[model samples]
Target chain A: MQIKSLNDCNVVQMEEKLDALTSDEVEKALMGLIDNGAKRIVCVFELTEYISSAGLRVLLVVAKKLKKMGGELVLCSLKPLVYKVLDMAGFISIFKIFGSEEEALKSPQEK
Target chain B: MVQGVKISLFGNLILFLVKATALPFVNSLAILSDLGISCVALAISIILYYSIKLADKPADPFHNYGYSKVENVCEAMEGVVLIGIILAISVQAAMNFIHPKHTNMPWVGFICSIISVVINFIGAFYILGLAKKSSSPAIHAEGLHYRLEGFISLAIGISFIISIILRLNGLNKIDAFVDPVATLLVSFMLIFPSFNLARSAFFKLLDASIEESSKMEVIKLLGKYSHKYCDFRDLKSRSAGRKKFVELKLILPEDIPFKEGHALAIALEKDISRNISESEIMIKVEPCGKDCHYIQKNQRCPYL
Candidate 1:
């Protein structure tokens, strides 16, 4: 994963596969970004091919942490398989998901 | 469509040649299986290119629905091909496990696999982007195949590296088993995605409903104007390729004029169109209360 600043939002671009093996690294990196005062985060999943339950847990943790800080964690550009998994896990209603980065950036934070 | 086919064909050809050249030098079953997958991918790309061309044809007198289903057909074919390749690789890997052979030129195979991974990574990225923009299932399947190929190549490269390390430490027997073990792993990895692709294509061929979120969006749009009509019934929806087909029946009071009911249906259709731009909506307005005989006979309409 790579973190970059896009306007006011911190964009975290993910790699191809996010399984159990790579989820820990991702979680740590995201936590480090949050520690650095990066409040509003937009996770860009354009390159993510597959995401396992462990990856979902990482996102859930980040969402909870960001919510406590009065910030937001939005997701964008999920692949069909990843989207299906998230929807099946009932996380679709919990998180604000957009079809593109531009849409995610334009939308307000979920309360 | 032609351009995507050409790109895929050229990319697969290059990767095939590179991997095939390394196969003879390495004598690794993993590289051989990877080469086989690339061969299958090349054939699939050619078939998909032609299928896309056929699918692009406009609707005619004989076939009013056009040739959009050709994409689904091609996608299903690709899935079948992958399954066949997986089976073949698995058999070969099992045979190799029973009688292991030493792999030569591990470094050459490693480098070749690395090169293939890099090429496939770039190819899959662009192909997936194109698939999303055009909403082509064939292209999307091809993109996913390439992405998996990249990971498979990387795994093969790692196995080669591990075997080389083992050989250096004087564990030659264990090193010999690495090729088949890696091949088996790669073959097993292909099962899930191929199955998913075929299953989704099958559902589309069966004319399944669109995703739940899209359905909810349509229902929510209709719910906004629930008070305008006496009742809404029999809302049905299904998706074919990039298009969504929706059919609904709206019941109105008998006192409402035909023109007003027509206007309401048209307005509701527009609202649905605004919500789902790719939808083909059909709204039927039926007079309710005294005019609906079914309501009079059963004390209620079946849809109501």
Candidate 2:
């Protein structure tokens, strides 16, 4: 897990595998960033090889938190398996997603 | 490609010489097995040099898809060679098991094995880097082979040292069995990469689909234009060598003009190309629902 702040957005890059074992850590880290007054969050899933429902739950929680703050939680560079999991869970309709970090950063902020 | 093969060939030759030199002095089955595999490696490297050259040939009249399969063929051949080496090692190990001979000059064999392992490690690293950069399966397969061989050499060297130490402690019978046991262990380890190379090459030869992730990427790209089109359907994709072939069928509203549909397809292709640069895309736009008369033919129709 790595976080890099760019301009007004915080980019969180997930490591190789994100299952039940690592989901709690992911949730804590994202919550830590949100608690620090970070509004715009972009979770990069390029390096993530696998992500189970637990990981998705963490993303959903972060998304809800950002939505409450009138900010946005965007996802970018999701590997196929993760994308399918999200799509299957109907989270694709709930969250804003982009193909790359640049595109996610350029997206309009939620009001 | 030629440079990569040449480097691998020279490296394998040197490793082979090192192992072969130590084989006669040590009288160890493990060293013999290592020497035999290296001999096969030297032969395969020569074949790989030609295969790489042949695989680089552009698409011609006879071969429409170019010579990419030559790389796959070479990879499969390497796998077969490794299997043969395994078989030979197994037979020798069995023979040694029945009538074991204690290894002589164990320290010299250990030193040579270490040197070869180091050389192979460096060679595999360099070749794998080149393979990734060029996306050449032949070079990649060769690199995998060398990486496995290096580990085997290291194992053989360690076994030699262990056997020598045991011999010094007067455990002569145990020392006698060490060479064959080491050979068997290394030979079994060789199966994994050999099987992997063969399986991958076989699939590529049969024209397998591109990875699921890449296919999903195409679908995700099309999702951005969901509102513009009635629906996107029948997205198919396959891969050959480094090239990806994508066929996308999009259902458009009947009211949309043909020019607009074509423009949408072109734009979508551009977007997809941005993500998958090696993709060759074909987009077919059709009227939505019952407006598509071809739907009655019981063909692949999303709006049935």
Span of ten consecutive residues with least summed lDDT in model 1 chain A: A61-70
Cα lDDT tens digits, model 1, B253-300, are 666778888999999998887777457789999886554334445444
Q: List the residue pairs that clash in candidate 1.
A: none
The per-residue C-alpha lDDT of model 1 at residue A36 equals 83
Tell me how large the interface RMSD of candidate 1 is: 18.6
Worst 10 residues of 2 chain B by lDDT: B295-304
- For candidate 2, the TM-score is 0.69
Fraction of real interface contacts that model 2 preserves: 0.00
Q: After superposition, how far is residue A59 of candidate 2 from its true place, in Å?
A: 19
In Å, residue A103's CA in model 2 sits off its true spot by 30
Predicted candidate 2 versus true structure: per-residue lDDT over A1-111, tens digit per residue:
889999899999987887668978998999899889888999999999897645665676576556444467899999898898789755798789899999999988865
